[model samples]
Target: MADLIPPTGRVHWVGVGRATGSGLGLVCDEAATVLWGRTVARAEARLEELGLAGGAEPRALAPGALARELVPGDVVVAMLPAAGHPALAEVALAGEAHLVCPGYAAPGLSPHARRAAERGSVLLTEVGLAPGVDHLFAHDLVGAARAALGDRPAVAHFASHHGSGKDRPDAFRHHFDRAPHEALTALLTPARVIAEGLPRRVARPWEEVRRLTVGGETFEAHPAGDSLPFVTTYGLPATWRLESFARGTLRPSGWNAAWKPVLAELAEADAAGVAALAERLAAVHPAHDADRDRVVMSVRLGVHTDDGTDWAGEWSLDTVGDARESATARLVSVPLACAVLEVAAGRVPPGLHQATDDPEAVRRWLTFLTARGIVATFRGDGAV
Candidate 1:
């Protein structure tokens, strides 16, 4: 990717959603202009309301025009649904431009990865908060811990929890900040984790719920999905006594309790029944355009060593946004926009990849985040 980049580039935003809306705004701040594409007029109108539509060239992404709107050396921020990523990857490759998205690349992206390789374009996925910021923080923590431990035999545990909600409390304990469908899917899907030194897949969502308080706000953190893969991604040695590692999502105080009946209904309901439940939830907890919201995330790595020496390293982020902006939007969009600029400037290495945990890149990225109002603190042996 470093070898492929040109001295400058243009940005094209595909899809218009919560994070993508903010992403377009940030991209516009950096670049002179941006191309905004969406399938629906209502979505485009929303962007216009957010003040993102004016400076951007809005276009309708009708059918196959995704590939036709681009040229070489352009950077495409794909905020399309997960199912649409594979085709978008192909479009990016066909246009010979770098691709950046907040989600993981689908299986259909493999062939396009090769094509991107030949064209010197890159596919960057999983570049959002959890998979993005948390990954970087985990890498830094593990690396720092390893350096401090030296030759000591150690045991390690890692965890990351994140969620967002309105500032004013609500019965549901959460709002549809992003696409309601995505939240619905997260609520219904089973989570995977490493438990008792083995991979444990939970058949239900919101299991093993626990309380978490950060920056004076409290939330319910639920077991999300497998985090063992990050053990290697963070460069923890297999020889270390790795006891447990997991990543989970967080919600406001009464989120799990409020959604319990909804989950129960979804499990036993038919297709139509599921849709009805989803509609009810969305109607009741619609995202408020004028409400302030908060985003909190914590990443901790604990190491147990010989001779009873024990300690842990921790990093956390807590922030709130007002009616005109949001913590969720800024955290998700800024990093992605910065990444696209990095790729354009020849900072990212070539080939297909997800969110990178490279220490240098992470430090730079974190610095950028801090500049953009998302401050994170890190502690080694003591509090920051």
Candidate 2:
């Protein structure tokens, strides 16, 4: 492990987007916090909206603006798009400050991680919602299976989905920050997954939609990204055989039926046509203030030996938005807040790291999330 820079107890949180929620309050409670937004006024407004008007300082985010205020040992929490992470990371490394983000660890971050380790600064990623809590569940399940079955060969399958809790008759239910069509368009790209003990490419993931039941509710699920890499990340025993594995998005039941027309339109629509369709869909299905969002994630694993000894278990999270905060925002921000605190405490070594797999750290994070009313239930045949 590299020598970690002692934290200064000051945090600079960048961006005040929809995903930014009560988690900010948690960080504010423990650190001298500053909230950065597109403009100083926008940052101030968001603070007021979050009921944290005077809880933290508000600043405008511009090129070099955040870099100017950063100092060694400070923590920078990025709540912006994935594309902006590298730039913010550059700023953090230059200032010898730690950086944290909820997004996946893109390839661009590899070099930053090397530099961060050398500079004694932490760079934590994937500590929110599906990537965050789901990771905890997977690690715990795999650890339990290993203890019980001890490298025995077994078939394993994993899936995660996010859908609206409230039923909507429309084609789409959730609100998006960008063009909704782009999300649909991105689905055209292929994803890689482990299936039948081999890696396979899924050209049209949406075409392979399958029914997934979580917490007694059935929803539509399809793989979203490359999942083969996570087999190593989750520390699965090399001796175990994988039947199926995927990390995917979940949608309400009957999503395919509702999306059929939209998919057909996207197939042949040009750029201009797609933009028009997006505009039309936005108008037809505008989000309502009364709407409530929900997020559900489940990770299940099973192991078996030739003697027929078996171990099966699952950990699932189901949370809905409340008057206080949206479910997506709460789930995403709170775990991220937890990671920031851990980094501040110098528990995480300086370098690039995902949500911790250490048993104690996993327990601590899950317990903290439970106390905040985000609980993941475990149901299995064996003790975990």
Candidate 3:
């Protein structure tokens, strides 16, 4: 079997569902292998599809069983739903397994993070694109702002367009049919480490679709999810005027408007209603099928110095699936693959760490991905 980790250290992989498997399997080749489930037909099919060939067996996600075989669960890659994560995050830390993922915010991350830190095992989340790399980009901007002004700026604006291009809105409805609640209609969701001061603002998802025109192309974004936490992570002052948002990326015109009705109705709809909405939307505005999917991210930061002079900068990244895989899978999974390796190599720290603290890791990931097809760019390099 491909064992990218040491022969003696085995990784217990949980939630080997479709997208997570795609990501977990990529970083693990001959170094450290998944201790269980490799031989299962579905896993085998996935591995075979992803260009990995191994003879490892699939086992249920049991800490005891895994500990017996892999011995002390030193490393784990979890793809369980956000709600299911905290308990497992706790278990993995207790087992001494350094953990990582590309997921959105979860209550579990902060709680178990402390235990992982005391134990010297890392627990990393939001290590993927939007939440992950996007944070890293925020740190860079803050660093630049400080370099220019010698102190934190008085005001900053952060926003993003992070969404999916589904086959049909309900194309993946079967996946969420059972969870009638907790859909995007209910929730919403950046950056950097001065590691001291943070300016924060919170808003519901898509509630305020801030409009913008970039490179002659206009798009919209909105505030969502705990973005205020970043103001602290970046070491901005409480008085620092900060506004940040994360929204779905869209086409130049009418794309967001096209789906606004469905999303508007999301709160009132059950699973069936949501599914019907997606299908109906697809009949007129269909998502790309079989063709590669893509994620386009833009992080724009505006800093107004205490003296009132203003400086602004931006970072843009566009990635699509390779001929071998989907971009959504790659953007979400690949950085996570490298993160697992970081834990294995002792590069990342334990405790609820976000991707922003690891700039070098981010650079390496972006570089490696570029070799495969991801495109990343930085603008207004000097204003930083």
The RMSD of every model to the true structure, in order and in angstroms, is 2.9, 2.0, 6.1
Better of 2 and 3 by lDDT: 2
Q: Better model by TM-score, 1 or 2?
A: 2
**Which 10-residue window in model 3 sums to the lowest lDDT?**
188-197
TM-score ranking, high to low? 2, 1, 3
Residue-by-residue lDDT tens digits, candidate 1, 1-384: 235845256777777776764656777776654555555475568577678666676777887776776778788877877788877777777777788878765465656766677668888877788668887788788878777776477776777888778877688677775556666666667787777777887877566788877666677888875565666677787667777788888788887788788777777876677677778877877876688888888888888787676768888988788666677777887778777777766777657876776878877887877887778988767342
Best by TM-score: 2
**Would you list the C-alpha lDDT of every candidate in the order shown?**
0.74, 0.83, 0.57
Q: Could you tell me the C-alpha RMSD of candidate 3 in Å?
A: 6.1
Candidate 3 error regions (>4 Å)? 1-9, 21-26, 35-39, 55-64, 166-207, 214-216, 237-240, 243-252, 267-289, 356-372, 381-384
**What's each prediction's clash count?**
3, 2, 29
| lDDT, candidate 3, 3-104, per-residue tens | 122213456566555455355665566246663443456556555676666633456554466545444536776766677667667666556566776775
TM-score to native of every candidate shown? 0.88, 0.94, 0.77
* Cα error, candidate 1, residue 147 (Å): 2.4
